[model samples]
Target chain A: MKKTIDTSGQACPKPVLMTKDALVENIDELVVVVDNPAAKENVSRFATKQGHTIKNIKDVGTKFEITILKGGNKEETEISAEEFNCAVLPSKGKTIFLSKNKVGEGDDELGQNLMKAFIYSLIEVKNTPSTIVFMNSAVRLCVEGAEALPNLQKLAESGVEMLVCGTCLNFFGIAEKLRVGNVSNMYDIATLLTSENTLTI
Target chain B: MEIVITFKLTHNAMKAKRKVLFDKLSAEIIPTPREISKECGFSLLFHDSTSEDVRDYLDTNELKFSKIYLRAVVEGERKYEENN
Candidate 1:
């Protein structure tokens, strides 16, 4: 009997593991379906490396279905699952999360000054972070009269998305003084932080 | 055009920054670009349009700085030529 294993929407290692488990069960024939190119490539490579023969590979729209025949050395098929690495590509530029107006601990004035320098440096970089989210006192950097305003404006103009926490703005009583970036809520901020690679400062 | 003022020390750079803003000039404290000088870690960046006023103000307040430069972007690379 041919067993079908659906690994669509699943990242690497998971799909590879499912295929490996089915192969380990001594299944004569099996079909592995994957939704992404990475998963498809990884599963196919894993099957072939395990000494199994790939009977057919059918590209079904955005997904791929791979049929494998178990006819290899059992010792080779016994390779550990951890041996397979997941090659998930970074989807986009990183997200910078600024929770405070300063960059580090110690002297408040010095930290503030350093923070300004940090923002200024970003304008010089070739590849800037895709998004910069400001929360708490960090929101002050986006308001009017802020020393970092112009730098932030330049970054925003250069296609970097800026998300300033609205709750933090109102709490600081500077919501109306925002000179750059959009006022964002917690939900949007949370989504960016979790969905993208985030660097908190 | 942009004017950059490098300082002998980071504190001096920070102090000069405060003085410029106090004098109603928009200035920012930035790490001194290697093109300017590798010694000073901090510098003040502002518009070249305010060069004369900024220079006069710094001299008036006795804010000693290392050097001044006119920052230019040549071929997408920052070039700092001595303006003083």
Candidate 2:
């Protein structure tokens, strides 16, 4: 009644898809083993969406064993084509790291303009990042007078978590001027950057 | 409702922003909306209440602007209309 699928070294929906295939084989329970965090999360989310309950998730060193219990009427389990779209996957471990007030090298004015345009475009994008971490000069963007404050505020209002480095704020002498985001420390920032898929700008 | 003022040059837009901030006017410099054409890539956004004051300030300051638009919220969507 229990089936084991070792999806080690497999990518993305492959693990989720293989698990789905096993779920329909009249099995009462399924154990999916994935090596990467992304695969584990994908498989777990897929199982949950298909009306299967996760009984347990055990982490053994680099691997994870996710045990899922088949819900009632397994024959009725169906995931619509729209639901299977990868773009609809939850953004659980995505982070954007902003280290400077400007976006790129070259003329300071143009860099600043590019940074503003980047943040504005990010807000309009379909897939919003889960979190945006500001450090060093980038903390200025979250402060009162910075040009990008409004866009940062809009992003915050849309459920994007913002973390402004406390040390950097104090260094810039603008700690009190921070108008958005939670004050964070180096430790928390490092942990987030290491754990999540970070896009540095 | 929101109002956006776009300038013909980035320099003029930055100057207008500094003046607005210095005068304690509630305005923010944001990326110019794609629907509007202006030489400057950035625009100033503020509440509709300050529209006339902003216009007067820019006029008195000799800040050359391309256009001004009023952004209204209609049934959860934003609609922009040219004011000048």
Candidate 3:
């Protein structure tokens, strides 16, 4: 009682739309095979929002088989294309605006310590932001020999994109020391801040 | 899926958190969870067992802070697990 929808190499909204149609039909069980993480998340959220139990999601390399149980009645289903559009909650990642190397103003020693605490605190959180924009004094954070550099590198390795301001680096005259992440211009920085849920620190 | 909890800049709360770590609480500063935030910073990572103790210490010391949250991780995900 299982049907597999091979959404492999298919584009967005299609994989999700296909999954929804299959699920509403009460196909005992539905398996959506998608190639990317976003597709998986979109399909998973779509299914979850519909009150359909996601029995299991098995990942094999980049391919994911999202197994969903079709236990609900079909008569009360409101599965629609419009609903699927809103099912995907604006990606789980957000943007972080680090305008200062030290967390707060005042004593330099205390400010640096506070900044350290802030980075360490970020690591201890329940959700990680998608991007961390390093500008102004914060540009020093990504330079070599920086304490926060280790953690920032780790975060970058974990799929978090670190955008260090190129102008900030040039202004500080330590652009060569920039170790982690790509040198970003104001164009990218401003776009990230406006597009995502941003937290300025 | 980790959440952020802000602490009031109080001596006792800072002292207590340090003491717990000084006493060797299995905690370390980790990158904030990407699901909730991307701002890298220091956060306390503790097992479920010591959460109550941490809460009690914060309460008794009248430390103001944000909420304690649990983060979801995919099983077998690799990340540094130590205090430094």
lDDT of each: 0.85, 0.83, 0.71
Q: Which ranges of candidate 2 are over 4 A from the true structure?
A: A1-88, A107-123, A144-151, A173-179, B37-40
Worst 10 residues of 3 chain A by lDDT: A72-81
Ranked by DockQ, top first: 1, 2, 3
Per-residue lDDT tens digits for candidate 1, residues A27-139, read 79999998988777778888888788999999999899999998766564454445665664666788999999998999998899989989988988866999999999999
How many steric overlaps does candidate 3 have? 32
DockQ list for all candidates: 0.71, 0.36, 0.18
Show pairs that collide, candidate 2: none
Residue-wise C-alpha lDDT for candidate 3, range A106-181, written one tens digit per residue: 7775576577667765665668888999999999999997767877887888888899999989999999999998
Deviation in angstroms for B35 in model 3? 22
User: Which wins on lDDT, candidate 2 or candidate 3?
Assistant: 2
RMSD of each: 6.1, 9.5, 11.7
Residue-level lDDT of model 2, residues A1-201, one tens digit each, is 999999997656677778888987888999999987877777898888778899999999989999999984545555544454444445574699999999789778667767876887788778889999999899999998687888889999999999999999999999999999999998999999999999999
Q: Write the per-residue lDDT of candidate 2 for residues B14-44, one digit (tens) a residue.
A: 7777787787777766778776753338788
**Candidates ranked by lDDT:** 1, 2, 3
TM-score-best of 2 and 3: 2
TM-scores for all candidates: the values are 0.66, 0.61, 0.49
Candidate 3 is graded, for docking, as: incorrect
